[model samples]
Target: MHRMKEFYLVSDRHIRYAMMKAFFDARMIEGSSVREHGVMMLSLVEKLKDLQADFNKEETYVDVILQSLPPSFDQCIMNYNMNWLEKNLHELINMLV
Candidate 1:
């Protein structure tokens, strides 16, 4: 019998590129699309996985996304701490919707 381990290759450049792209795309979210946008952004941020040292990056990303929303979202933003570490992205997405 033989045992084998599998490994996958990932490029730093690709990861960085993806992160930036997702960040920019999330920033572009607005109005009625906030739900779908939040979902996508959440997925993108989660994809960072081991590439990110801590949740700070995700926190900043969510903060920017919230700031980019229209005035209607002001109350939610004000009521919540916007601390990604304290809140789950799925909950944020639900609130946005």
Candidate 2:
């Protein structure tokens, strides 16, 4: 566990991820294997870098406001998700009849 924490202390994100992978590969932790980590862990690094880039911006009111807006903001007409149930119970009843 000490070594795991030491590896995570490194500034390089990729190295941290690799160390995490090694820890999981050795079957050290339960309910969480490296295969289940997926791209989300790496995405955390990317999100941090993006925030850093946004922080680096040093400027006055230039004629442009560079901001990130949701891609489906105004274009979205519906926010609900449908499962479209197949009516399995009804099918079973029809078969009995």
Pick by TM-score: which candidate is best?
A: 1
lDDT of each: 0.62, 0.30
Tens-place lDDT digits, model 2, residues 17-85: 554444233321234432333233334334434434222322210001111112332122122113232
Which 10 successive residues of model 2 have the least lDDT summed? 60-69
Pairs that collide in candidate 1 are: none
Residue 47 in candidate 2, Cα distance off native in Å: 0.2
Give the distance in Å from residue 55's predicted Cα in candidate 1 to where it truly belongs.
3.6
On a 0 to 1 TM-score scale, where does candidate 1 land against the true structure?
0.58
lDDT winner: 1
How high is each candidate's TM-score? 0.58, 0.21
lDDT per residue as tens, model 1, 1-97: 0111113354665665667676655553345677777776776666555455235555676676676677777777877764433556677678777
